[model samples]
Target chain A: MKTQTSRRTLLKKGLGSAAAAIFLRAKTARSHNIKRYPNSCGVLVDMTRCIGCRSCEAACNAEQKLPSPALPFDDRSLFAQGRHGSKRRTDENHFTVINRYDPPEIDHPLFRKIQCNHCQEPACLSSCFVNAYTKTPEGAVIYNPDVCVGCRTCMIACPFYIPAFRYSSALHPQIVKCQFCYETRLKNNLLPACVEACPQEALLFGKREKLIKIARHRIRNDRDRYVDHIYGEYEAGGTSWLYLSSVEFDQVGFDTTIPHEPILNSVKNFLAMVPMVLTIWPPLFAGFHLLAARRARAEKTRQENNREKADEDV
Target chain B: MKMFNPENVHLPVSGSKKNDGSPWSFQDKVLLGLTPRQYLSQLCRNRVNWLLVLIFGVGIPLIVQRYFYGLAAVTHGSNDYPWGLFLGFGLFGMVPLSASGFLLGTTVTLFGRKDFHPIERLALLNGLLGYFFAVVYLLVDLGMPWRLAYPMFVSLGPAAVLFLVAWHVATYLSVQIAELLPALFEWLNRPAWKHYIAKISLGLTIAGIILSTLHQGALGALFTYAPTKIHPLWLSTDFQWIHFLCSAVFGGLSMVIISSFLISRYASWRCGKEFSSTLHDITLGLGKGASYAVFTYLVIKIVAIAHDNEWEYLLTAWGGYFLLEIAIGVVIPLILFARGVRRGSVTTVRWAAAIAVIGIIWNRLNVAIYCFNYQLYQEVPHWKEVWLTVTLYALYFIVYRFIVYRLPIVFTWNKQSRKP
Candidate 1:
């Protein structure tokens, strides 16, 4: 057999290019880990408590000093507005938006707030080639606009599609998304604008560990009312922003099929092979050249010997 | 090895010269041995020149406006779909088709296939331009075009798939340029420069393979980051990069056939006797290679589906689209190529090559645009975006012609002959 298939060598000889590339990938990125923050604070959101109030959205806009939204904060009419078959996602103008999901036989619609999930292992942080994203000690995923080249790769990498670009600007384009109010609140151990503005007490602020217990306790206490699970406990490797809801996650526009592991885990295998290819492919191809050249030389010598014999006879 | 020369072309291997045995001036070289008046007349006579003028009139302004007014001026400013035709068609679509350089490089230099020497330089040039212009397309799409070095020199996200793509493409572009250095030296008639390149050709060829292997696969690996966003059929974590790399082999080879077909048809003046004589054989060989690659790609695609156990997905409308893609790009081309190779039918092979190129482009577009966020509503790119994409492509064509017109690509330089 031209190719060897012994077990020790597959891992020892390397799965060749793929395994080595993944193995040597991101040697410098060990410092920027998404799992470093265990005691970092997080916000647990209870969907059952929300009343579709526009107060939190208004507070977020005011706190960020963002431009007024196209529709007034008090307007519930925007719930019917959708373009290109999708509802209003967060954009450069707004960091967070709530979508109303009407459950059948229920008198009122369930208002689900959509914002950056602030994943433990964030897709945005991993995908940004410029290292523009920073997963802070306080569990908020912050972005540095100055370094952002605005490739918009973060948008595609994001499972929740949270990162939005300022494509309207020609001179300077920046990615706009929620930072969990890192600068104004989370860093200083204060409540974020949206959390403080929640009149229904739907937003709870605590350590991520405590938030998990709170989520479980709530689900266990209300067996029939709650869906016995925390939405962000493991989705995309556990987002800092956890969710509790009465309805199925899909019905409320949540992407639950996303692998429980971090998005980076999906590509880790390929990255491991990069180093192997860099080291192995060069020598492998060059050795092919050496072998072919040797054969050509041997053939040349044989032909020359035959020609010499004919000349001697003549 | 014998040098390539197409006898059907205008102007012989020798440059236009004075009767006293002096070579033509720089101006004459630029004119491809034609006089100033003759060159102007030739430009005016060609229909392609007129089309170029029309494209420049519309395209240049949009390109300028894109920088002046921002991407929103020339594209449908959709924040949801950050990448449009510029990246989908230009970077992704063009890069794979340009893979011929390394493929041919490894075959000729590494494997010692001397018979394939005649078309190696052309493949190298094609690869160089494809990669160079892919970067050009990237610059146009980047929000901060000036900070392109950020991935390399500035804040580094070495862990990211894009980081690998950026480094590999940048290095590969340089490697491709080095691989074509001998041809450039030959065109300049500097034998010493050509000899210097010959010394390091093996290294350059090896670098080309490693870089091309990674970056081409890295393009697909870029999608692996978005597991939930892209359609499942298009996204295979285990084999996504392999699928891309395998498909690229044929994508690159088929492109050479298509480009050669165009050259044989339209720019016959540039080819020499060797090129003309060898073009048919080379096309057939490339077709055979493409058939094998397409078959391999089809198998791996099925394996990916099986590994993921996504058979039920085939029952959906998306499955029908996937089947259609395979039928057109893989099955039809595979059948035509196998028959064409056996019967020595260059026409069938040519048709198969064209189909394969289209199939590759369609696949890239499907990944980058159509099936991305399949659950979300579809996006029809702004008309301006389409025009801008066409404009960049036209520019690529113009540069290609300009180089082919002067370079020792399809023809070898001959010292014995004097005067054009």
Candidate 2:
């Protein structure tokens, strides 16, 4: 197992047996279409249209039944608040937040609403050991509190830093994040409360395939008003939510440096070696032991033979 | 310094009779053959004990309060920084240092390097305590400490990196215990049990190597998930596992060297002639291994940089911090170890090893806390949280000292069942 798990020992023996369903489905999906995701859903946010009303935040809090915010949602002063050089981000209490980004080149400050990107290959789902996270066909990244062991690996794995642990809860602590309203809205064919409550018609709900086209259409037609890129089209292997900003995505607090590939791509190199280590290390080390033992026995016999011959000669 | 006349020392073991000819009891063993009053007086004589008492006086209740009032009472538990010192220093820092167990086990048992046999048991004990304490740290850091076993038995997410860590650590902990069982059995005067373990020692050692390799590297791979969160210089996606695994090699060796130095200085009374006399040579030998490992780690770290094409980031402030870590932790130790080994200076090697050990902790801290969320506000550890970590380490110290004092780790056993 030691040698096999090295770069060699990658397979999880227990998991291989227990949860073959997920793997089987993945394989089936791969066989059907090698290039694209099948029937995935998505959302597109138009920053040019956003009024920074905070109605989405208010609606999300009411729908999720989360604790009330420290200040009322109507307070415009929250946009000025920044910490550690960054704007206010999503936390346990607030699943989604709008941060005011002042790009000097642009006349108006951009209001960037940050939440779970709900990637095609969600890092939280991949990194979870208990399989607590699921990427729904409707483009929602849902979390199961029942199976969550609260290791908080998901929080660390997420490229967007979307997930948060309810550390304050001692007895029944679990991960807190936007599930894209998977349970109360998305699953029921209704729009996420945040999307429905957007007063400026900024949040557009549609199939992930169509959202890409819509984002490109807006950028392609209005070249000067919008940046030429869609924020989540390929970032972290494409997310359910696509964004079109007037200025650069980084100017509006988006992590522009995220890789085009999924987060798992980085870890797969090491994981691939685990099986190799497990398979090769045991026999190789055991062979070394056998050779050493043989040599020691040979030396011992040689010394004993010489001693006996000397005694006979004497 | 007065040389210890280790030849006259009698090691602790079962069936050893007392001066009056009566057999030694378990109570006598626990009390170190001294009366309760004498033991108390001896403990009180040390200033260190007083400090430990002060730490425990405050630390113990805080631990209780954490359980009752929850982790929020003791920790910042910040949403930005989910993992604090408990994991960064305790699990990530300590596990690699404990790699000595497998390295030495493979050296003395699998490869049959009889010269390292004297200090091999010490290496094994160091590994055991490091791992055990790491788990203790995990217990304190985990939000729902009771559900720790969920990754193992209840709802196994075998595909998860943490799941692999949980299984491997638990299994390896057992393997290490088995590898050390001969000594434990010998101390208990159970020759039969010792003989039984001796037959399977090779298997246990091999298991240790396998588990140690994957898990040590897996710990680094854990950070691979947080590509954006961790600073690029600290978090290498391509070579993160290799970087972690390679550093652990030196980290583990350096820890063994540090433990040996401490044992020679503070545990002379417990060491046998063979152990005390040969420690200098062993220290040098271990230094050579560590120097090689550190050099490899440095090269690989550079390779990781090149592979990622991260040269541009080098001009930034985070790059300076990364370079400082390499210079102080890796480069200095590598140079010092190389020089110390060549000069055959035990003191030089000892200092080099100490620096290397500190480097391991520094590197882990950089990854888990310092460089983590570099763009966010730093989460300073709560004073109680820091104290609790200190308390757990003290407990680790006490347990380690107790085991070394009683077991045939530092000392040589005269039992018939004992073997290399």
Candidate 3:
């Protein structure tokens, strides 16, 4: 009797697991396709044209209404003020920073300005548990302070290390980052403050598709002057802001080791397990409990029946 | 309590009646049948209480300063290293140690391992307090602690890994509380409540197993987002979740062994004969379980390195440090637990459990802080931040002790108390 019951249960368990596998496969197929907007705007930064002028920095401060800098934006001494032998980063007060990186192989120092990359599939948007981050159709990654729980998972998720928290204000702390001037300028189809204020004509703003074409054309036209690679073209699933550099990107403080795929790709394997475990574990373990209890009961009943037969024989 | 023992002085308030056959009141149970003055003296007698007082004395003011002045006042407030000791040592470190609740729950309730019934309540209580305190640590670390509910009610990013973590931890906490309600009911002499919990115990255990498996994995999956930041040797997106879940199995069981060992040694006066007599065998059983888990964990760690082709990293200095962590945290504990269980040496197992507990915390800290941002400079936590972390754990200790003192967690409840 026990052997028959065990065989039936084994069959049931096998069928149940097969059904779960089918369900899981169907669920995962719909989740991996990330949508892309066709008409997103982007910025093309020509690093060779930049002459380390701080006009864009000044313009960003004024446009964003940020606090006045400790040293005037014109002060060249700020270049030497990198803490821990590292470049200055975006913070609560500043939306962007231009760091001076001197390659040993080059005659002149190159200035690399960085802010939010606003990836095609933004890690910040995907990682925010409260929906605090959004990748706008305009190719801007924006944050809603009202909905943010300030868990700082976005900070961890960002490959560019762009988001900055307002650690100073306990009452109204928020994540401060570049939103591509979306509210004040992007919606009006005007150039971002930094791009408009560039004295070098180093910053070019256009449709992301057009910008990519323009970047390729410039690289092809001046093959000796510029590196063959277009930074951010496919990096982290292709950021909105692209860079053209004279030297290797790693020499100019760019993290050359970043994966070409989106950050969400790495986490998908774990997320796929969530639904599978939730659906399968309860029934699986509950079945085990029932089976164990049944076995226990069967053993007790057989012993009792054997003892009664022994007494009858006596 | 030992200092003022008098003949005919009935203590611990185990049953409904006193030594003189008088009924025990609520006050008697709360005070362990001691006078108000005696209770205060007993509290002051314990040296551990003094250390807790000292921690809170400094930590409470620092906590108040953090709230008024912001995170910058307490933490280094590094934009690069957003998480510090608060999260590194609190959330990641504590959560894995708390996995005991579901592991033991499944063993006793689902698998019908009736021998494990003696230590089941202690495991459940350990999990409940560990999780509860982890939330406390999170509240302190969050930028807008008030908006904690926003993820659940105000806004939802259901696709995120953290979304799974948030939902699973919340539900698992409730499930754990329900699973342990029988002990609470037994202590309160509420037979009806206990009986009700008995009906749903199986369901709660299954829920616990499911929730533990996911969230334990989700915590590791959180680090996958920072693949570029963390050192490659420590981060394996393919097996990160499995690494976390498997380690948690030994971490939780080891915690139970450590806790039971401590209870049997230091708090033996409060324990019943059943708990005291069988604790050695139970420790061996738990140690055997932990040894198996640790062995599996060791294999997976090696497999993770091989899968990611990170063997070259072992030749570097960072690789050396990683190897040291595995040696001290995983390998040593594995060997000790294996030998101790085989030999039935409870002392060896106890030492192994202590080391394993620290090893798991070390692994979490390595992932969350030490090995994070491998290219950037390291950020050491502020003194205030470290103090606050200690303060929260001290408070956790006090609450754990408070519950163990009053409830029938380490000891069986007197079933006859309900008859009167």
Candidate 4:
């Protein structure tokens, strides 16, 4: 009876292990198709064309229905200081901001438009466990405040430092960022408010492929006027918003050192180890348990044999 | 306190019980076996109560002020540094220190190191409370603390590293609770539940290992999202997770050592002879593990720098700070651990463990706050932020003390069975 029970247990264990292995393989296969949207919409901002106008900023504020800024949109003194400090950022009150960079080499100041770059593979979307973020087909990275836990992880995960939290709100809070106007405008095939409001036509909205081509064309045609490279063509795995600047990208506050690969790629190394640990740890630990139990098992068997011998003798 | 000690010297099993043998009531237990009047007298006699009163007198109102007015009332309100001391110390620092659950679980259940069984329950309790309070810290820092569950059931961002961390940490918290159920069962005198947990112990342990591996690595991976912002010396695309995991091994083990020492010193009344006797040996064994982990961590740190070819940054001021962190946090504690292990000095090992714990905190803080946005100006945490962090940690301490006082963590159960 004991032998029969042991045999049954061994068979069960064998079947369970086989089933787990099969499940693991199937899960790995399914994970490959989980890439972000490939044909998402994008924007290209040519810094050479920007004349330090804050019109885009005002348009974003009005479109989002955010509270009006302390400084009026016509106040050019905000640029003369050339430093917005903590005020110059995407916040609960503002989804985008334009910062002026005065480089020693350039005669005129350069204006850099700051907003969510909306990477082809967004870290914010991936980092959200509740799935509050989505990358639409139009390439606009959007967020749902309803599902937001206000964990502020998107703020941490954003490679472009775009997502801002409303920390002061004790009752209701949400992350603020440029969503490319996905709900109100982009979904209806209308351009984002900021892109439409640019009087100088500094911002171009279209398919990411076309935007890249357009940005490259402008740079190639006016090499002396524009920088040799198109920013965000590959940065952080190809952001939707491309940039062409007269000065170097870094000089205009662009983080040029960001890798071409998506930020998610860096985390993949660890994620790959998750399934391995889950699969390997059980059997490996169980084997150790069996080994550790060996001595105790042998001792129990010896005691049983002695008791049986004594009973026979009596 | 007369009820705490029986005048009669007989009945060894009921050494501290009254002659007419009855279990102490919950209220009586709280009073430490003293009468109501005596309990009040004892409370009044202790000078520590006055200090606690003074602290609460000032601190509680400040905490209330935070809730009524908003975070801006207390914090510097700098958007440039969204995360302050609450996250830097409470989240990043506390989580790694709390890795003791997975470490001890892997030790006894996975590696079959039953020799270290005496203090296993304490280590598990330490882990559970650390994580529980880490979440509490997270809640206090979150803008919408009430909507904390929105990310789990409502929204699903499977692609994000933070999403993975949230899911895994939540799942792992449940796993750790389940892993700890055996101790709870033992305390509750429910042997059947203990048996049930033991049956599925292997599965629970494997789950713990998997979740811990991902989340600990994910915390480091979270920083990888800000490649240009974080200091180049700390950011290694290929080895960031490994660096985190390796350091956490030492961090968790060292935490266990420190906790064990504190319990042994302050709560000897609560500890059993077996725990007290075996704790020193376990400390040595844990120190050995910490040494091995720190040695590997040092190697990985070197390899990460080399792999990134960030040797040129070594001449910069940030590089000097990195070196300082390594020297003070890693190298010094490692030397202390080695010497303590060789000499069989429990005191030395205990102090080394404390230093190692601090070192781990320093390392995590460096990654999360100090060296982050290297090109940007340094962000000093707001004074209110600092106070709030301290208050939250003090609450963690209180909870820890409460559990340790009541649970069978430090003390052994069923001592009568061992009697010949």
Highest DockQ, which number? 3
Preferred candidate (TM-score higher): 2 or 4: 2
Q: Global CA lDDT of candidate 2, please?
A: 0.85
Docking class of 2: medium
DockQ of all models, two decimals each: 0.70, 0.54, 0.74, 0.41
All models, RMSD in angstroms: 5.5, 6.9, 4.8, 6.6
DockQ of prediction 3: 0.74
- B297-339 in candidate 4: lDDT tens per residue? 9999999999889998888888898898899899988898999
Model 1 chain A worst lDDT run, 10 consecutive residues: A27-36
Model 3 steric clash total: 0
- Per model, kept true contacts as a fraction are 0.83, 0.68, 0.85, 0.62
Misplaced by over 4 Å in model 4 are A1-40, A80-87, A295-314, B1-20, B47-49, B110-112, B182-193, B414-420
Instruction: Give lDDT tens digits, candidate 3, residues A1-314.
Output: 44555878999999999999999998876556556678889999999999888888899999999999999998988988877778899999888898998899889999999888889999999999999888888888898999998899999999999999999888888999999999999999899999999999999998888999999999999998899989998898899999999999999999989898889999988988888998998888888999999999999999999999999999
Please list the residue runs of candidate 3 whose C-alpha ends up more than 4 Å from where it truly belongs after superposition.
Answer: A1-34, B4-8, B415-420
Interface Cα RMSD for all candidates?
1.0, 1.4, 0.7, 2.5
Model 1 CAPRI quality: medium
